[model samples]
Target: MKKNLWIGGEYQSASSYMELKNPFNLEILAHIGIANQGDVLSAIKAAEDAKDIMTEMPAFERAEILEKVAQYLKDDREECARLIALEAAKPLKAAKSEVDRTIMTYTFAAHEARRIHGETVPMDAAPGGQGRLAFTIREPIGVIAAITPFNFPMNLVAHKVGPAIAAGNSVVLKPASQTPLSAYKIADYFHAAGLPAGALNVITGSGSKIGDILMKDDRIKMITFTGSPEVGRYIRENSGLKRVTLELGSNSALIVDEGVQIANVIPRIVNGAFAYQGQVCISIQRIYVHEKVFEAFVEKFVSETHKLKAGNPLEEDIDISAMITRGDVQRTKDWVEEAIKNGAELKAGGHSEEGIFQPTVLVNVASSEKVSCEEVFAPVVHINSFRHFDDAINLVNDSKYGLQAGIFTNDIHKALQAAKKLHVGGVMINEIPTFRVDQMPYGGVKMSGMGREGIKYAVEEMTELKLISFKTE
Candidate 1:
């Protein structure tokens, strides 16, 4: 069945349509209505008109509706997972995990809705202000433009939209063109959960056209986006002072300290590097091993990467699946070839066919090579050796991105030092850089984008602080 645009709480068709397909199998899923500039205008207008209605609703009421939506998601978990797999080419196993996380995202949003508190300011402390009591109140930032990426379709969308609604703001969602079905499912869940009409609208079409409309529109007070750094920078510059939360790219690093337990680390390193085909922003792309443990770590890591089964996403045995498109697969292959040409040693699984790229492991990838420095949104990882702990930290910090980094060391002193010295947003002592929860403060430094993204943190970004004071005495 063809899918229509969810605008103003109604599903309607457009004159033109976009044919949605399964990139793994090339099967036609549906033709979503191609929203034009006019459609985008309508969505913005609808959200603007619905602002008072959303703002006037009590926080408890918003919490109830968000909780109901979370319940609805839990009820239709399998179907939602299937939709994510079909649309994004994520393996069903990983897709199910994403749906589970999406459920938790909304649940966290519900929890935060009731507890969105403000702070008391010391206005009277100033010499001029005597007997003036001042406090801060958080208010919704009006209509928000939520633009999500193709990877982690559901949860990323939830990270933006759930918090926007919880903060009492209407949203105009522009989901990735490849994975609009999941956004449609989100819209249905919200609408069925008794959300006010026009409070949440989903428009599916050309990202450039619709995004330009949203970026230029003054009605949208804020924009939350997750995508490439180039596009993120463009949005930031062009939005012209609009409040924006940008979650961009990363070539995340993981450091294997000397004498770490290899048996426990191998499986985690494999999963962190290749899970979701490394399309994740903070997916482990670079590994720096202490020279003493380099050879052993590489051997074990290769062994684990070999055990992964790649096939159709629906298969239970599959560990990795296809990229979003063949073009992406080819680009990954090209990067591998370029790295190999520049003195990198290919260790295991560098071949790709159809849309599935094998979990590739490389070593000796120079810092100047594309694979070592750039965000490889593919199932690829590079291993290099460092002489000292400071050397390892320096190598990891030598990139344009500082999203997240991990260190595997039992040394408490080393771990603590690295936590402070590393230039990323979050540091995991024993876990992988890919470790993330729906409730933790997540985002990065440098080119990895600005601001925080966990449900509570996102609520802060989606709202503005207003100073309320009263004069007495």
Candidate 2:
């Protein structure tokens, strides 16, 4: 397939193009037109031109457009899923799930479009303010620049673009070059749904070249990004006065307490650690099990993990597949090897074939080891024992990236206590850290990120509050 850049609701080609290859096998899936810095500037100009059109549109009209886009996606669900799997090498089942979530995200945005409410102020409470009437209103911040990551090309893009549109803001999107087909399809949906020209523009090319343009443009009022902490920091520092919402990386942890049933949660743990090749930001990387149930937990966890099938992502039963690139596999392998050299014992499956690394489990890993400390964006997990609940909380909070943590305990008091003391964005009681629905306020503390990402929360980030007051004589 040949994909063109979508700018101002029109598809166009450039002189240079890039080929997107399947990560599992070096097969060219599609050729996407590349946008230079000049093209990026054009996109920014288009979004700036659409500011009045977006702001003047009625909320019901905006909601209708978003609903139509959601219907378009549902009409072509299988095709979208196949494109995601072909470009990102995600398993077919997981790709389908992602498509479902993307549909829900747009639907939620549609609902939020009509629900932007403001509250009236009580001026009578203040002295000399008897006849004054005051209230606050939310308004769009104009042009938004959305930079999305490759791991979740469809849904993460939806998280940014959907909310921006719901908040009545025009957008210029920069999808990851490695996976631009999904973004292209979404742009087609927006156009087909009768969104006005220039309301949404999708640009594809080198992130550094186009990203710099997006950041430096004064017309852009906000920038929303999802990537590494290093890039997030750069955006924060350089985005001068523009509102920024960053969804950065994480090394998520999970705790298994003494009273938990080992058999009941083994499957959840296995899926949490290995799903989508463990490329997700909140994929389980560090696990702390209470000493009383440590042996039983490891035995069942490794047994279930080994049962997962590794094969072509197109297959229905394959649970493990290739990483985004061979470089990622190599980095993950190097970390695991370093941990082993430092006296960590490999429990099962620690090798690589082609671009796929086996779902690996390690024990006795030191807290300072690379595999334990760093964000290993591959299918590898480290399990350590903790004697008490306090010890488990300390172990989970020891890392710099406190995105989300999970604790399993039947006692309500223990679970509530852990929720209060975990030092992360979310503490899942009796659930895995990978648990996330599209409607919740999702973000992290410390190095994880700077803002939340649910549809309503994201709309808040994309807008600004204005106070309107009047004196009634």
Candidate 3:
């Protein structure tokens, strides 16, 4: 199948194309159009042209369009899930969950569209103020550039586009090249829902080729990106004065306190660490277990990891699949080897079979190891023992990336303490760091990125606040 760029409400061919292959079986999925400099500029221009239309669109109309798109996604949920599995190598069941989340995200955006209002200011609060009224309202921030990642392709794109549309902003989307099909599918839904021409455009290709153009263009008012810290930093440095919302990398950690039921939490931790082969930004990579329960937790974790089935993502029974690229697989392998060389004990899995890295667990790993300190976007986790609650908090906060961290504790005081001192965007008291709903204010501090997403917050990011006052004589 051939997939072309969706620009100006039409499918346009490009001069070059790249084959998208299924990572698990190496089957050719589709030939995706590679956007060049001209293509990127054209997409930005299209979005810029549609800005007025989008800005002038009524709140009710935007809500209705988002509702229609949500219904369409629900109707074709299975097909969309299959596309994600093929393109992103996400397991079938996990892909379906992502589709469900995408639907919820759009639904949330639809509801937020009507609620996009500002507050009334007390103009009479000042000493000289009298007989005056003042209020603030939000206006759309012209054209937006949404750059999405390969993991959770549809849902992540929905996180950006759904909210952009909610705020009445035209979007120029550059989906990750490996997973452009899901983005194209979303564009089709928006088009079918009667979005205006040029309101939303999808350009797919290498980031190096088109990313700089999106960042530097004055026509694009905001750039919402989800990927590595390196790219996010480059965008922040170069996107001069344009609104930027970045959801970057994370080395999320989880702390397991003493006296908790180890059996109840082991499964949750295992799933959090290995779901979708651990490509998720909030996937738990570090575990600081209470020294008393360390041995018991490690044993159960390894036993559960052994049961995970590694095979084709299309199969319903499969729990694991191939990494996105051979280079990523090799990098993960090298990291595991290096950790072992540094005196880390390989508890469960330290190797790959047929390109799928096993759900690996390591113990006695130093804080400086790559798998412990860095955002190892793989199914690898390091387990360490912490004697005190403060020590656990410090251990989780040791990383430069502070996206989210979790604490499994029954103690209210300890949970509250971790929540305040974790140095991350979110703290899950009893839940895993991977636990996120569609309606929460989600973003990170430090190297994790800036701004926030999740419908209402994202709408706030995509809009500019304007104040209006009327002085009555």
Candidate 4:
């Protein structure tokens, strides 16, 4: 199947190409046409001029268009899911779930559009301002550049695009080369929903090659990026005069306090650690369990992790999908090796036989290990024991990544204490570090990322606040 780039509401082809590999067997599914620098410029030019779609379109009309797009998403569920599994090599279930969430994101944005009204301030309430009237207004920034990641490719795009529409902004989308097709399907929804041409555009290519051009162009008013910290930095450094929001990678940790129910949490913890082959930014990369339950937790966690059936997500019963590429598998294996060399113990599934690395768990891993510090972006984790709740919290806070963390404890005080001290962007008490609400403020701290995603927070970041005050006459 040939995949086409969605440009200015039409399917277009690229001059260059990159192979989309099936992570399970290391075979090419299809070749994605990589966009050239020229294509990048075209997208930017279109976005710069398309501001009328956001600023001129009525709010209710904008909301209606997004609602139609959301309905179209439901109509094309199977097709979109196939594209996701083909590109990102995710399991069918997870891919379907992402599509489902994308649909909701669009619908939610439609509903949120009405909530964007500005408020009028009474001058009588202000000091020395009798007979004066003041007010605040929310308007769309002209052009939004959305840079999404490989994991949750569809849903992340929705998180950016949905908010852009709700806030009355024209958007230029740059989806990950590995998983760009899903975004095209989204563009199709816009087309089917009768959105005006050039309101939203999609360009698929090397982020490094096309990204600099987009960032440097003054047309791109706001950049919402979901990728690695290193690349996020490049965007921020090169983006001279544009507003930017980043959702970079993370090695988020999870703490299990003493007196927690070990059996009750073991299975959930294992799933969180290995879900999506651990490609998720907020997946549990580090686990700090109390010394009392450390040995038992390690054994149970490993045993349950082994229960996961790893294969193609397209398969009927596989528990985990393949890695995105052979290189990803190799890197994950290498990190495990380095962690072991740095005094971490591999309890299960540490070797890489093919593109599919086994679901791995490392115990007694030192703080010095890369598995504890870097974002592995694969199904490998470091599990260690903590002597005290404070120690566990401290260990979890030691990393530069602060995207998300969680604690499992029945005691309300312990949960609250950990929630207050975890030092991450989002903390989940009595759960693993993988929970997120679509409307909540979602971002990271330190190297994890800058700025928040989710629709409301992104809207705040994507817009320039302007307050108008009137002189008393």
Best by lDDT: 3
Could you list the CA RMSD of all candidates, in the order they appear?
0.9, 1.0, 0.8, 1.6
RMSD (Cα, Å) of model 2: 1.0
Candidate 3, residue 348: the lDDT equals 85
Tens-place lDDT per residue, model 1, 1-473, is: 78988989999788799789998999999999999988999999889988999999999999999999889888998888888889998999999999999989999999999999888888778887888888888999999999999998999999998999999999999999999999999999999988898999999898888889999999999989999999999999999979999999999999999879888888988999999899999899999999998999999999989999998888767888999989998889999999998889999978887799999999989998888889989999999999989999999999999999999998999999899999999999888999999899999999999999999999999999999888876
lDDT by residue for model 4 (413-461), tens: 8888987887788898887778876887898888888898777777777
Model with the higher lDDT, candidate 2 or 3: 3
TM-score of each: 0.99, 0.99, 0.99, 0.96
State the lDDT of candidate 2 residue by residue for 1-473, as single tens digits. Answer: 77887888898787688888999898998888899877888889889898899999999999999999899889999989888888898999999999999999999999999999788999889898789999999999999999999998999999999999999999999999888889988999999888889999999998988888888999999999999999999999999999998888888999898889889998998899999999999999999999999988999999999899997888888888889999999898899999999899999878999899999999989989888888888999989999978888889999989888998888888898888999988889999999999989999988898889999999888889998889997
Worst 10 residues of 1 by lDDT: 311-320
Number of clashing pairs, model 1?
0
Model 4 misplacement above 4 A: 122-126
Q: Counting only residues 3 or more apart in sequence or on different chains, how many pairs clash (N, Cα, C under 3 Å) in candidate 4?
A: 1
TM-score for candidate 1, please give it.
0.99
How many residue pairs clash in each candidate at the backbone level? 0, 0, 0, 1
Query: Is 3 or 4 the stronger prediction by lDDT?
Result: 3
Worst 10 residues of 2 by lDDT: 7-16
